[model samples]
Target: MRIDWDVPITMDDGVVLRADIFRPVEPGEYATIMSMGPYAKGLSFQEGYPGNWNRMIEAYPEIAEGTTNKYQNWELVDPEKWVPDGYVCVRIDSRGAGRSHGHLDPFSPRETKDFYECIEWAATQEWSNGRIGLLGISYYAINQWQVAGLRPPHLAAICVWEGSADYYREMSRHGGILCEFLGSWFQRQVVRVQHGTGERGPRSPVTGELAAGPETLSEEELAANRINPGQDILDRPLDGDYYRDRSPDFSKITVPLLSSGNWGGQGLHPRGNLEGYLAVPSEQKWLEMHGDTHFSPFYTDHGIALQKRFFGHFLRDEDTGWTQQPPVELQVRHPGEKFVQRSENEWPLRRTRWTKYYLDPDGQALGTTPSSGADLSYETTGDGLTFLTPPLTDELEITGPVAAHLTLSSDTTDADVFLALRVFDPDGEEVTFIGSNDPSVPVGLGWLRASHRKLDTQRSLPHRPWHSHDEIWPLEPGVPVELDVEIWPTCIVVPAGYRIGLTVRGRDYENEGVMLPGAMYPMKGTGPFLHGNAQDRPAAIFGGVNTLHFTGGVAPYLLLPVIPG
Candidate 1:
């Protein structure tokens, strides 16, 4: 392999960005796989993120197979895999991070422009063919959506692995609840690799120089140059131009895409992949969903095989038979921590049997129809309400997005509803699994601050309801309002003698079993909020005496996308 370091590409703004390219030793002409992001390029995976490296290697030994693991970095494609295949694998440190010059802020318009110019630059290089493709995980993947919309002339295709599309809806907030990940992530990861302080950052193994630029600026200059897009999100807690500028207008992205989403990434990654797949105007597209650690499957043999096949067909015109592959491939999850491979023509399957399970006000049972014309109310401080189905006589599968329509009244001006879809065995023990955020988690979860329940009609789907969080409508005390709760998608099978359940609470879902090892991040001042916690839900903003009101007159019901047996 040949390593080319300190490769400079001058952007339109005259900012010189740095890149590290890994290519085959005897390369004449080859397709280029590129990734640009903030995380320092020189930082080793094991040194920067030991937990992720350990988990990835533990799950897929093949990742450590073949060439040396020297080129492996966090959340980007492995050069070892691509370099051996007669392809040039390039990693660029975005401005303000790594060895790049200028202010550091991710997904900004300036960064997008830099990415667009970088693609064209890679295309015109002496060792390069005009065709270029983008491949990476998380940051690298997320930005692809932005740059693709810009439609760089030399860009051919992209593999967006575990990236979210809507910056506001997916990354900054959950069910209209503000997220603290922006601040927390910036402090923990972004700030460390930010450009500045002359040569303090790690040096590229291949270059022997800093990753961002030749020499870093002073702290004052670095801060002035760096832009914190996350802080903008926190400033504007609603859908506005600030968020839209960072979001990809799928209609503008015409490039073929292989979008891979994680079934476990309920917080941000999965929603983006799904949204991009459905919304992007591209005629040639594919979707793949899997269950595993966030960073594991993306770099695994299975993931690499799929990515190469897709890119080969698009960039190399290899005709690798990828066109014959299924459009949608899902690793359907089972109850016993197993994934069942299934392929379908479309998402939310066309033949989805939509079943409505009504909320019984009397016994808090979830049934096919309403039990009586009586109101069921619960305190905001108490277990709001629960509805359950009888034990299944046979194995039943449910695999899609879920929704709930509630007629609720609050003692205060607003209410917060937290919905959890759960499974229970014959012993009545609740079944849980490892979620993207929390290890001990439930099947599906959703949340909504009652005032932000207004739906965006054009964007709402049968299986998923999109909210118009652009504005809030406070409630009148004791006045009933209709709320459509969007329970994030999931796949599960309830065995015979097992029951399916739904819990409508005023707050987040708490693990009923043994607690996992981690500091608890909860809602309000109460227990940990597994779905949307306190960092995102300040009491002054969400604190209210919430109420779950139900009756036959109101017809509150939970919608289940059940896969008929």
Candidate 2:
């Protein structure tokens, strides 16, 4: 392979974004795969992310044996794996980060437009073949949706590997509660590689050069160069034109798509992949949902094979038989990280039997029969309560979106309800799964801020209650109101003698196990996805006594999409 280092991509407005291109040694035009992200292009995966790198290598050995990995960037494809296969790989440092020069504005219109121009510039290159496909996870994957909406002519295909499409719903806020990820992410990851990091930041171990920039700058200059993402997120509590402009319009994306979501990614990954596949105007689209570490799967033998098949068909016009593949592929999860592969023509499988399990206040059980005139209250800041079903007599498979209906009153004007769908072994041990970010987390998780309980009826389904977070309706203190909480999609198969447990808490879900310091996101009570901002959920508003009303005429229940075994 031949590497063209520090190539300048001049945007229409005269800013030059730096890119590195890797092409086959043989002189011939080839379809291109590119990633445009704020993460420095020169930050070698092994050196920059040793924790994830070590874990990924141990789990998927073939990944390291497959290539030299010299060209590998975080969450991006290795050039060694693709360049030899008649594909050119390109990595561009988004303006104001890495070697690029400009005021850093992450995920803004300027960044999206610059990405569009970069795509077009790549198409015009001599080694381009005029066909480019976007490939990566998270930041790299998210921008593909945005640029694809701009509809660059040479953009042929896209592989959205665990990317969130909606900025507000998936990233900044969850059910109207502001999460700490945006702030933590900008500080830990973005700021280090930002344009003015200069001598203040770490260098590229491999290149023995500054990864953030070529020139050193003062502390004041560094601070002035970038936007404070966390504060920016806090200031904009409501989703408005700022977020709308940052988020991509799926309606305008018509390219062939392979949308891969992680079932355990309740935080940011699952919703967008499923929603994008269902909403994109693309005639040929595929959805694949898996469970495991967010980054490992993309480099595993299985992931690369699937990606090659899709690009083979769309970009090269090769009959790789990807078209004959099922429209949806799901890794139906089970205990001990086991999964049963299932293929279908549509999502939420047509055979799904939507069932509601009523909350019985008596024995803290989930059943079909409703109890009467019962009110169960829990401390808002405490480890709320757990409702379980009798150990299953037969295997139960749940494979789609989950929701809950609750009739409740709080002493305060607003409250936060955190729900966790858990699994318990016959031996009485709580079972957890590997999430996109967390090492151990419940099977499924759902959250809602009582004030933002208004539903988007047109987009709501029995199993998936869509919330319109545009406005907040403060409750009359101590007044009962029905609220529909939207839980992200999950897939799990329960064994006979095992039990399904639902835990509702005032705060984020917490697991009892090892927390990796090297995780992409820090493992907080809920794996860095906690929503306890002082501004969004003040102690006075969300810390008051909350009550769950059930039985009587009002039946509070949890909805599950049970699939036939």
RMSD of each: 3.0, 1.4
What shift in Å separates residue 303 of candidate 1 from its native position after superposition? 1.3
Candidate 2 to native Cα RMSD, angstroms: 1.4
TM-score for each prediction? 0.92, 0.98
lDDT of 2 by residue, 1-565 (tens): 8988889999888999999898998888899998999889888888788898998899889999878777668999988998889999999999999989998888888999998899899999989789899999999989989999999999999999999988888888888788888899887888889876777767776576788878878878878978887887788877788778889999999999999999888788899999899999999899999999889889988899999999988888898898688999988898889987888989878999999888888889988776655689999888898999999999999888899898888998888889999899989888888888887878888888888898889998888888878887989888888988888899999999999988888888876657675766656435778786887778988887899887444698889899887
In model 2, what is the error at residue 483, expressed in angstroms?
0.6
lDDT of 1 by residue, 519-565 (tens): 33432211222334554455654455655556535577888888876
- Which runs in model 2 stand beyond 4 Å of their true positions? 517-525, 551-553
List where candidate 1 sits over 4 angstroms from the true fold.
197-221, 373-383, 512-541
